[model samples]
Target: MEQDLGIALPLDYKELLTRFPGGVFRRIEIDSPVANEKAWTKYKRALDELLEILGDEDLEYLDKVDYTPC
Candidate 1:
């Protein structure tokens, strides 16, 4: 992942994410893919599940969600 990103993600971040692999503070997602392949895959799968279960209205802010690959 660091090789793909051309940079090393902070050890602290990896540690935190490892311990708590889901959700950020108050459950707000950052809207951008991280420097980790597993994390990004998990996010996309979650979004797809949300859309399937909750429908399009749940994705109203998708335009505001950024997708610039790291």
Candidate 2:
């Protein structure tokens, strides 16, 4: 998945995914600056709308955050 996304995920995380497949644990919480699915989707949609409203500069600003769009 990381390879398909052209991103480098942590080795431990990759191992965990390999071993568990479903996830590390049933209800594990990940706390990081990285945005989760819902937040990322919402942000991307908002950015797309903002690009229409505000133009390319808004996308450039968003790009500065260095998030990988899902």
Candidate 3:
């Protein structure tokens, strides 16, 4: 799936599955800042949407996560 997206997903992303098993899409941590604040905002908004969808689908799965952002 990552190959089709032309991106490589980190092995640990499976950790997210333990919490929100429906899964995430498109976003990844990167070394560089977004090109501009607008881009950063958009990125954050997208992540928020992903989290929202995951929450709606299944909250229990999230409990399986061993780690999460602080």
* lDDT values, one for every candidate: 0.60, 0.52, 0.52
- Residue pairs of candidate 3 with colliding backbone atoms: 19-61, 19-62
How would you encode candidate 1's per-residue C-alpha lDDT over 1-70 as one tens digit per residue? Answer: 4564467989987777666645466778653346367767766677668657544544565456555222
Q: Which one wins by TM-score: 1 or 3?
A: 1
RMSD of candidates 1 onward, in order: 9.1, 9.4, 13.5
Once model 1 is optimally superposed onto the true structure by TM-score, how far is the C-alpha of residue 31 displaced, in angstroms?
A: 7.6
Instruction: Give the runs in model 2 whose Cα sits over 4 Å from its true position.
Output: 23-70
Compared to the true structure, candidate 2 yields what TM-score?
A: 0.30
Tens-place lDDT digits, model 3, residues 1-70: 3443366766667455344423225674442113455644665677768867776535677677875432
Best candidate (score: lDDT): 1
Return whichever of 1 and 2 wins on TM-score.
1
Task: Report residue 68 deviation for candidate 3 (angstroms).
Answer: 12
